[model samples]
Every structure is written in structure tokens, then in C-alpha cells.
Target chain A: MAEPLFDRLALIGIGLIGSSLAQVARREGLVREIAISTRSEKTLERARELGLGDVYTLDPAEAVADADLVVLCIPVGACEATMQTIADSLKPGAILTDVGSVKMSVIDQIAPHVPDTVHFIPGHPIAGTEHSGPDAGFPDLFQNRWCILTPDKSTSRDAIDRLTAFWRGCGSDVDTMEPGRHDLVLAITSHLPQLISYNIVGTADDLETVTKSEVIKYSAGGFRDFTRLAASDPTMWRDVCLHNKDAILEMLARFSEDLSAMQRAIRWGDAGALFDLFSRTRSIRKSIIEAGQETPAPDFGRPHKKGRD
Target chain B: MAEPLFDRLALIGIGLIGSSLAQVARREGLVREIAISTRSEKTLERARELGLGDVYTLDPAEAVADADLVVLCIPVGACEATMQTIADSLKPGAILTDVGSVKMSVIDQIAPHVPDTVHFIPGHPIAGTEHSGPDAGFPDLFQNRWCILTPDKSTSRDAIDRLTAFWRGCGSDVDTMEPGRHDLVLAITSHLPQLISYNIVGTADDLETVTKSEVIKYSAGGFRDFTRLAASDPTMWRDVCLHNKDAILEMLARFSEDLSAMQRAIRWGDAGALFDLFSRTRSIRKSIIEAGQETPAPDFGRPHKKGRD
Candidate 1:
């Protein structure tokens, strides 16, 4: 294997992203030492049990001390507080980054506490399952996935290139974009879809006409597809909604307008309008599959049940 | 093994559902003879090439002339026209049924043409992939899935029981529901989610701020989840919209109201509200999985690229 990229790597929240990072780092020999920390005692203990890192602690400051790289993998809303806790302890030349969905807010929250001597690069990886916590992660989570990095004007070229190399070493294709633009793009691609899914599931759950059991039984028709996104980690999604408020609201508004038009077409039995919109959306998934961004299997390649046929 | 349920079985519309039925009937020995027909000569030819049935024809009336069980696998929009052509030719006491997403609409279209001696049952199998056509099917498509049968009041017990057994032979757990109630339930569970997915994909595509390439690259975040449903057969979905107009509009209205309230919460930065809704939807997927209604794998168990991790 290649020489270790960093002497010490610190992950401050041992959740899905954090655990996956640790697994990938260990598998690829990217870091000589892995330091894991979490606010909750249970998570930290679970990380220790999983042997996700060489050293484990409850104090973010203790984990960051002398580490070459410190990544905050907690909810977006906690970035400011986490930054405040680790500010004094972060190694002088260490590179600080985050795995938050909302980039601009993460920048606004953590940029202030980051020491002048430290390099803070914000990042968001476009990969995950609906599952959460330490047990949900695996080494291959980043494989062929996109990891976007957003750096400020003050960030050094060497630091950015090094971190880019680190992400690439972890098996991610890396891209750089403006923080605000990143937030807006993800508002449509991530936040908006998750929010819509949550709302739809909530709607189905509260319906008086349809029983919850019925909803669950017949989900394969289409509703089950939305439920996976809806089932994502609540704390992370809530933080995403709160942090990227403006962009999410903008996308939701546009989405609402389009839905109203669709509702109108349905109400009026306008086959042409419905056909046109449905036809147009069909090609995008084809493009996504063609670009190798999505799987080509039907129903996400779900395996058939055993002993049933 | 069970003396084959029927001596002659005829299927109209040699698409995904039809091809799958043909394959399953052959695999399970559910019928001694299978006959297939479609409105499109191309599809009929393709079905013939695939050897989907023992006999393939361009005429619906000819297909059902001597069959004991004739399944209408065509779109709901064409049910009325096809019924008009085959009503006189359908053998007396032959059980006629359909596989349509909208139940009440199918019942309304075909009930008028059914003779008193014939039994017509409208079914909607809660199963499918994004792919369509004769080639896009497998015998296991309906395995461990629900096949809802909405039979008319006048239909005999022997007919419903036999059709239920037929679906069981096709590897489906059967359920009976009122046509209107089934329409409403599916409106929330299937129609609304698909419409919302279509609308969201459209909104992302029309964006001036976010490039399509970026959207495609970052789709795994959540948007791609909706694309699978959005990429479904357009003509079938379009016909569903037209046929189930009232129920679909009602569900869309309810969904819009809930979405508006969600937007309000996001605008006001209601963390508790967002968290509660996000958290609540998490269990629905769990229930679906427990009920043997969905796959338990995360992201539907998409496989990683070779030799990357």
C-alpha cells in the first residue's frame, strides 16, 4: 500500500458518515492513526466496539489534539458548537473539514471559530443509505460516489489539493463549487426531495380514508420508493432544513407551483399535459443511468424473496 | 402439479404485466395453453419472438374466443375500446379480468360489455419496475407481491375464488377491496407520489441556477430516488391520470395542503415540526419491510463498482 496520507485523522461524530470514513481510511491505509469522538456516550462506545478507530474519546477537543486532519461529521446545526469546542485544540497546521449537506451554513457557522493557522475546507458527500448510526456504514460507501468540496478564498491551494487527493484516495470523484451554489443545487437534489418525501409519508400516515396497514401493504406501487428517502436520519434532515432554509423554501415553492399545474391537469383530465411532463421526466433517469450515476435495475434491483417461487 | 388451473388462458396486451404472466403461467403450469394479443403489431411480434405464449395474435377477439380465462393486460384507457371488440366473442362462463392501476375506472369501462354468463374481475398488482414492454419482464415480477382483486357484486363466488387461486399460483397474496376505496388508497400510496416525483424532476430540469450536469452528478443524495418512479411507463401513467381523475385530484389536493404546511414550517425554522415529521416517516418503511412488502436493503442493495474499495 501507499504511505499513509496523514499521521493522525480525527472524526468528531461517529455516525454513518464518520464510521464509513474510518472504515475506508483503515481499508485503504490512508491514515496511520484514527481518532473517533462523539457527543453521545453510546455512539462512542459503539465506535469503540466496532474498532472504527485506534483511539476513542468523548471530548471533541481531545480527539482533535495534534491530529493532522479533523472532520466534523455531525448534524449541520451542531457545526458551530463543535467548532467552538475544538477551536483551541485543533492542530496548528491541521486541515479542518465537515461532511454537512448545507455548505453555506456550515461555512457561516464554523468559519469564525477556525483558527487562522488551520485550514478549513467544507465538504458534502453525495452518498448514504436511509439507515444511520455507526453500524450502518461500510468501507465502500464512498466508492464511485461524488464528494463535493467547497473552499473559501483564504484556503490554501496546497491544502485544497491535499484534501482532494484524500477524498480521491477514499474512492470518491471530487468536485469544487461555490458554497452558496452548492447549497442551492443540493436544495433541489437532496433537501427538496427529502422534504417532499417526508411530507408525502406524513400525509399518507394521517389519512382517515386509508388505513396505515393498507398504505404499508401496497407501498410497492410507488409510495415505497419515497419512504426510503423519508426514512433518512431525522436529525440530519432537520438540520438540513433549518440550515438551508432559503434554498429549500425556493425549491419547494417552485415544486408546489408545478404540482398545482399537475393537479389541475388531473382535475381537468388533460392527457396531453400529463403525458408531456411524464414523458420528459422519463429521459432524465435514462441520462442518470447512462452517466453511471444510478443503477439500471428495476425497483433498485431488490432481490426476490427466497422459497416463494 | 395441481392439474393446471385452466385448460386455456388468453392474455391481451403483451407488455410487462402480460409477458410476466405468460412466463409465470408456463413456469408454474397454471394453465395448459397460453394465448397472447396486443394492439401494437410490433409488441405482438416481440412477444412472439420471446415465445411469451404458445399462441400470439393481433386480434383480441380471436385470442379470447375459446379461452376459459382471459386477462386484459392493456392500459385502462384502451379497456373500453378493446371490450367493445371482444364482448361478443368472449366465451360464455369465461372469467375475464384486468390488471390496471385504477380499479373503479377499469370496472366502469368493462362492466358494461361483460355478458351475464361471464365473470369480470379488475385487479391491480402492486408490483412493477420502471421498465416496460414485452422484453422487460420476468416470471418473478409478482413474487411475494400483493394482487388486489376488486370484483363486481354480481360476480359469482366460484369465479372470485378461482381467480384468487390463479393469482396465488402467480405467487401473489391476494386481497379484496371496494373499487372506490381501492382508488382512494392507491391515490395516496401510488398516484400522488408518482405525480410529485414527476413534478420534482421537472422542477430540477427547468432550473436556471443549477446545471443539469450537477443535478445528475449529485442525484444519489435523494433526487434519484424519485427518478425511478418518475421514469415509469409514461403512457400507462398518463392513462392512469385520466382514468382515476377524481381520486387522484383529491389525493393531490390533500398532499398539496400537507406540503404547504411543511413549507410553512421550513420557512419559520420549526425544527421540532420538521424533526417529528421526518422521524415519524422512518417507521413506515420498517413496517413495509416487516410486512414482507419491500426489500430491507439500503438503497435497494445497489452493488458497488468492481475492484474499487
Candidate 2:
């Protein structure tokens, strides 16, 4: 299948994204061989047991040695150290990238360690489920999702093109943007939403006026929607908050200011102001659904028991 | 089949909840005849086109005449005027109820107008999708969902039992609670979540840094989940915000406080705090899923294109 884009692919962590990459790359023949690595020996063993790659190891440097493509699939917080461990072992002409949520911080952490001859491109695939770890991934994880690449001007076009092709082969549509802009965009789109979700869930949990049992029972109204995002991998999300601080904090402040205004509108019984904001937001969801980024199904197409009619 | 619960069921609105009740009542033979009313002639015509009820009219008074069960399924803001208009026409001994999200305000608005001969109970079926209007409803909308009834102590147990039976027949598990307690519980569970959803979508839409096109295209990361709740019927949510102001404001204050703490943690790079909150929130989603209030499917089981493997 198109002579396989790379001779050997090294994934430095076997969490959801790493496992997904391995499976999709293998299924679509994007790479000739897949080498999986993680800090945890148990996770490495789990990757081996799943038959996820051609080779598996707990040593990051050993896994990247001789690999034509090296992807740092660990949490953003781990990128700096992992890059340090594997920097010298990277093949001279290897294309290096990552699947972190925040782009600017990831680039800052790994770019210094990247060899001159090695291509370092930061990428983020806007796809995942609440689930994580090796068993939680599937070959179709990237299907119909966007994989954004943020490469510096010095990177060769051929290297970028090859990485784009690899992601396309794994069923992702690719886009390129400046890493700083990528961080800003994702801070609003991903990081802010995730933080808001976790915060709301925590607030609900800490409420003495309403019991947790009651919250769990009545979540179908709306709270359950936030829980899915709140249930995301802790390490990944924590790293995202830590790494994407400025943009996330900016968005959070804006959101809070708007929320305070909303609270005022509610307290003052200004139906017009409330109606206007609520009405305006409805069109955005329509745009998202029309853009094919979301399902048109009711209640996210959660299954309903058939009526006896 | 057992005898129908009511000889005539009159619904004073033809929106999502009203339309679904009409369809489910007919499908399960819970009512012998259904009479539907709405202020909007166009909505009434659409409901007629869908054959949502046995009788249709634009006059609430006409619709409730001689009805054994009269349900005000209009927005909570519209409840008082509709109740005043239909109060004289309601049949004596009839079960008069509503399906509004804010139980306390609904009770406050309609209690003074209710006839002493009629049973007045407020209910909220904790079931819905982002879609609205009569055409967007189906008979199975309430299947496996909770329907909460808030009846005053003075209301007869016989009437409550009959109404409970009707909801059960429509495939809802029923619970009864005090109107004030119901409002407080729903504020945390539904109203706050919805407001946060709308506010976040608003914040995202107003951002000059991120184009609307980019936001919509890359929404699958986490923003799309908020969009679902944000897309709900504007009139309905606005009414909810106005009627449930105290409880909603309380929850919003609590949420904002928690978010500020979270923001401080992120700004200071308190990784342990972030990780602890993220980790703790995961169990809440698990509890909701186990309570049968949510689906266990990954990504709400949104359709994924199959891999060619």
C-alpha cells in the first residue's frame, strides 16, 4: 500500500492516542513497522499482549533507535523528559511529531532536543473518547477527525508532506497552522471546555444542598453531558492545563465575565438579555452539525428503549 | 388492555414535551382522546399535520373544556396567563398539571388561578434532546427516563397515583418530591449545566482570536458537547432561567467559585490539585452511567466510519 510511508514508526507512549495510532497505522499500512514504548512496564506488556506493534520496549531511546518516524504519544508534561531521553537516539533523517492537545508548549519542550537533520512537527488530532489506555483505542479513532500539524518555517516541506500523508492514511484530514495560533485556538475549543466540565462536575460533587445521589439520578437533564468530558484521562488533561496556561486562563476569564453578566441578567429578570444569548448560541451548534463535526441525532443518539406500541 | 387512565387528555402546548406526551399517551392507550392547544397557529397546524392529537385548537379554554386531565405544557413564563384563560373551562375533578422545568415558580404562578375542584400537580419529565417543536418528538422520548412529579400535600393521593400511572405507561420511571426541593435539585442537575453550556458557546462565538469557521471545524475535541445543551429551545430555557432564578443563581455562584479556584490552581501550575480534581470527577460519570442515567458508549456512541481492516 503505497510503499508504506515510513520504514519504522516509534510511539513513545501506549495510552489511548498511542495505541490508536499504532492500530490505525498498521491497519492502513501507513508504516512498515510499529515500535511501542511506555514508562510503565505493565503498559508495555499490555501493548505486547494486544499485539499492537512489531516491537515493544520500556526504553524510549531503545524504541526510537533506527526508527524513521518517532511520535511522542505521552502526556504533554512528559514530553520534555521523553525528548531528552530519546534525542540522541533519533535517526538523523527521522520525522518527529506528537499528538498533544496544546501545541506551543509541546514545541517548546521538544524542539531544543530535536537534531538538526531530524524534522520536528507538532500535531494534535481533535479526536478521542472519554476512555483511555491501550484497550480503549480502536483503529477508527482518527476516522473523519482533524489532525492539525504545526511545523516551524525551517522544517522541510517534504517532511511535513510525508507526515500529512501518514495522518491521511490513518483516516484523518490534515491542516497546518502556526503553533502559537494552534495553542490559542485549541485553548478555547478544547482546553476551556474541558476545564469548565471538570469544574462543574466538581461543584456538583461538593454541593450540600443537593445530594450526589440526586445529581446522578437527574443528570439526564444536562449534567451528564459535562461528565463525559470530565471523565477524560486525568494525566492528559492536567498536562493540558499546566502547559496551555496563558490561553486557557484568558478563555476562563472571558467565560467567567460572561457568566457573571448572565447571573446579573438572571437576577434582574432580564428575559431579553438571556433570550438573546441563548438564541445566538443555537446557530453555532447548527454550524457545527452542518460542518460534519457532530452527529445530528437527538441526545447524541443515546439508545432509547423501544416503546411497546 | 386496561382501561385508559383519562377520558380526555388536554395538552395546552404543542412543543417538545407536549408533542411527546401526545404521541406516547396515544401509543400506550393512556388516554382515550387527546386535545392539543398552542398560541401559535403555525405550531398548531404543524401538530395537526403530524396528527399529534385527536383535537387541535389555538384556544386553550376550548381545548381544556370537559377534559379529565389538563396539562399545561407551555413554557413556564406562559403558565400564569394560560392557567387564567383555561381555569373556568376545566372539568371538575380533573387532574390539572404541568411539565415545566421550574416547579416552584410554576406552582407560584398557577396555584392562585387553579380551581379548588381540580387537582394541580407539577411534573418535569427529565428527558429531552437538543431538538424542539412538535415535529421533533417521538413516542419513545420518555422511555427509560425519569419523570418527576411535585404535588402539594393537599393534592389527593388518588389523583397523584393516576398521574403516576400515566407516566409509567409512557415508559418513564416516576418519582415524587416537594416542589421547592425539586427546584433546588434541578438547579444543580439541569439548570446550571445548561447555563454553563450556553455561556461557553457564547464565549467561543464571541472570540475574535478564533474564527467561527475554525471553532466549528475543530469542535469534536470537547466544544461540541456543550453545543448540544446550548442548542436547546431558547424560549424554554429563557423561561427556565427567569422562573428558577434563585436556585440557578445559587448554583451559578457555586460553580463560578469552584472555577476560580481551578483557575488559580492552573495559573500557579498546581499539577497535584489539577490531577486530584480530574481524577475525582471520573467516578461521578461512572456513577451516572451505572445509575442508568447515561449511556456507557464511547463518545455517546456517535457513529464512526469503519476501518478497512
Candidate 3:
């Protein structure tokens, strides 16, 4: 329908983000060819079975060979080694990017090996479900979501524009920011929330007074919401925690301090303080809904069947 | 046709739970007449506009008079005052119940005022959305959800049975628990999660490094889930915090301790520990989904529109 942005595109891992990129790029004709690679034979075979790419391999080097665009979709922990493996094979003037959640550490890991000929732009698409793996992806995963790019001043504007256009082709709006700022913003927005979710679910699991069955039965109250985030890919989250340690730890400290204040209010029966904080937070949800980043429906519009008689 | 469970159902507040109760009870013919009361004349007027009750008043005593079922749907903090006003006006042999989130505190506040002729059974329907007010309710709010009844030994068996049947008629499965046990169970399942949510949102709001707009824009990354819980009614949550102080404080202590351990794990790059906890928490979500307390759909089935080209 239109000219493809790149002659060949290489995906370095066939996980949720990689598979989603494959489907969306192919459906939109954003690339002429797709090359998929992963360390696991089963995953590579599964990608082949799904017809996710035109060529597949277990070697990151072979996948990057002759590719004009390469995207690392693996966990952040694996980026350094994979970049060392694929660096020499990347086509001159090729665009090298990634879908890691933490940008500063990912840039720190991959930027060194990048050849002067290749543009190394780190990115993160601020969207996903709790599900993971190749089968968990869909072509529309990036639809109406923000795809942020953190490119240095030395990077080519033409390369940044091309990558931005490609993401737009895949149905995402693009924003550019400094890598350090991206890390700080996402610390509060993503990393801290995920850690809190995991921590709360773990706390509920370890309770001596409450049975696990009771927690499960009555989870519809609020715990279930935290569970969805806690159900996310463990490896991905672990890597995020390791890679974004400073910002995450800082946010966690702040959250804990605020929580202690809330605890004091609860213990002292400071109804005014509790009400003020609760009232202030309601406007934030309203802002998110108005910003088109969240659904306006109640309960995220989960289907509610008529109650049993 | 089935006979009505009560000749009159008096609801002593008309917020989300109260209005939903009114609509569901009338739709299922569980009550012959409905009387609604709220301290705020505005809320009472709104209830009348929504036809949430057959009769509406600003006085609790007037609403409970001649009613076979009197439900205190107000905040737990107001229960003592409302019960005092309506205690003498209660009909003999009538059931006096409440829908407060905290069971033990509510029982403590209302039990001393109840006459020997009246049955005092406290309940909490484990259902709601991030919305409040009379207009933010629907007849299906309690459909397929659990309504826990916390009644002492002195409560009549026949009264408990009628209340259980009435909840079933309103489309909720009913479970009986001791008030103390209900408080402890809900502390983990509901209260702690809510407080954590509020605390995190407040943390994000108070950040000096990250802008509020940035927090709102990137909320889908994980922060938005907490915002829904944080957006719950301020007055109701404040009362819950104040009334359920001991259990909530204990749960909060457990969560904070767990969080500190997680923080240590992250700071030290303990990938194995992080992965283990994350993996363990995923199964809990699966159990919740299997138990029918959560929707099986990914992202709670929020709509994902096609990306902009």
C-alpha cells in the first residue's frame, strides 16, 4: 500500500513486545522483511509456527545481518551480551533501538557497542497487558499508546524521524525525552507501582491470621487490581528492578515515608488528613481518563453477568 | 411470585451502595416499600430524583419508623449517631443491619444502642467501582459478588435467613462470618490494598523530580490501577481507616516490612529473590480468576482501539 520504512527488520527476542512488533509491522507494511531471533529453540519454533517473521534464527548475529532496523525486545538484563553479539553484524546506517522499560540503564548497556554508522535510540512503549510470551501479543498492542524515544544529540535527526514514523505506522504517538528524565518519570509511574503491587500480593500471601482462600474469595474488593500487575512477567520485572535501582529505591522510600504518615493519621484518627489525601487523588484518575490514556468505563468495563439467584 | 422478604426496607444513606441496594431490592421485589435517609438534603433530593426509594427524608428516625428492615448505609463513623436517632423508632422484631466496611467497629458502635427486640446483623457486600454518589450506581452492582454477614450468636436464626435470602434476591452470594474474623480477613484483602493505593498515588503526586502531568500521562504503565482504588469515596475510606485501625495498622506493618525486604532485594540486585516473589504472586491472580472473583480477560477487557496511522 505504501513504501516500507526499512528493507529488513530484525527482532532480537520473540517475547510479547517482539511478537507484537512483528505482527504490527507486517500488517502495516512498515518493513519489507522481518528476522526473528531468540535463545530458546522452542520460542523460535513457535514464532515460525505462527508465521511471525520471514526468517528466524537462534543467533542474534545472523538475525542482524543485512538488517536496516534492529529492535531488542528481550529483558534489560540480557541487552549487553546480545548487543556485543550483534554489534559487528548490524548493517551500516541501520537503526538500533529497544523496547526496554528502563531507558537510562538500557542506554548505558547498549550504547557503547553501537558503531558510529548506526543510530542507537532507546525507547519504551508505555503499554502492555499482564500477559507475556509470543502468543500473548497482538497487532494492536501499541494502539493509542505512547512510544517514547530517548536519543542523544549526536544521533541523526533523520534516523529519529524515521523511527518515529515507523512507530506511528504501528499506531502509536511518539514523544522524545532525555534518558535520565525518562528513568525518573517512569520510576514513579511504572517501577514503583509494580514493586508496590508485588509487595502487597506477597504480604497477603504470607498472612497467618487470614486464610489464602479468604483472600482469593474477597479479592474483588481491591487486591485483585494489584494482582493483575503482580501477574506480569517476573523476569522482566526483576530486570527492571535491577536496572532502575536508584530511581526505584528513591520512589519506594518516598512511598514508605508517605505511608508512615498515613499510618499515623489512621492510628491517631486524623480523619481530616485522610480525607484530604483521598480527595486529592480522585482528581488524578479524572485527569488520566480525560487524557485518553485510560478507559472511561467503570471497573475498566469488565463484564458483569447478572448475579446468581 | 415469591413473597417480599420485608414489608419495608429503610436505607439510612443513598450513596453508591445504598442506591444500588434500593434499585436491586425493588427490581427483585424483595421489599414492599423503601424509605431512604441522608444527612445531606442534596443527597436525599438526588435519591428522590433517581427514584431510589419510595419515600425520602433527611431524618434517620423518620426513615426507620415502621420499617421491618433498617439498614445503616452511612459511613461507619456516623453509624453511632444514626443508630442513636433511629433506635427508639425501630419496629419490634425488625432486623437492623449495616453495610459498613469495618465489621467489628460497626458492631461496637451500634450494638449498645439496639433494643433486645431488634436483630443486629452487620454486612459488607464485596463489590464497588471507582465511583460514588447516588447517580453512580446500577442495579447490577452486587451481581455475582459476595455479601459477607457478620452476626453474633444472639442474632435470631430467622432474621439471618431472611437477610441472606434478600441479598441473594439482590444477586449476591451470602457468607456468614464473625465480626472480628471479617475485620481481619478484609484488612488484608481490602483495607491494606486501598491504603497502599492511596499512599502510592500520593507519593507520585508529591514527587519533585516528576511532574504531575507526566505521572498522569504515563499512568497506564502501572500507576493507573492504584488510582482507581485511590479514587474511592474520601469520607467512606477515612471512616474505614479510623474504624478499622488495629487490623489495618497490623496489615500495614506487614506490607511495609515486606516492602522493605523487597527494597533490600532490589538494592542488592537479588534477581533470584525478585523472580521468586514475582512468580509466586502470578498464581494468586490465576486463583482469583478461577474463583470467579475476577474477570479472565486481559487488562480487565479494557477496549484497545486500532492505532492511529
| TM-scores, one per candidate | 0.98, 0.98, 0.97
User: Which is the better candidate, 2 or 3, if ranked by DockQ?
Assistant: 3
Chain A TM per prediction = 0.98, 0.97, 0.98
Residue-wise lDDT of candidate 1 within A1-309, one digit each (tens)? 999989999999988999999999999999999999999999999999999999999999999997999999999999998889899998999999999999998999999888889999999999888989999989888888899999978789999998998899888999999999999999999889988889999999999989999999998889988888888989998898889999999999899888888888888888999899999998888888877778888877888654431
In model 2, residue pairs whose N, Cα or C atoms come closer than 3 Å (at least 3 residues apart or on different chains), thus clashing, are none
Ranking of predictions according to DockQ: 1, 3, 2
Q: Positional deviation of A262 in candidate 3, in angstroms? A: 1.2
The stretch of ten residues in a row with the least summed lDDT in candidate 1 chain A is A300-309
> Best candidate per DockQ, number?
1
Q: Which residue pairs come into collision in candidate 1?
A: none
Better of 1 and 3 by DockQ: 1
Better of 1 and 2 by DockQ: 1
**lDDT value, candidate 1, whole model:** 0.90
Q: DockQ, per-model, please?
A: 0.75, 0.70, 0.73
Q: Which pairs in model 3 have colliding backbones?
A: none
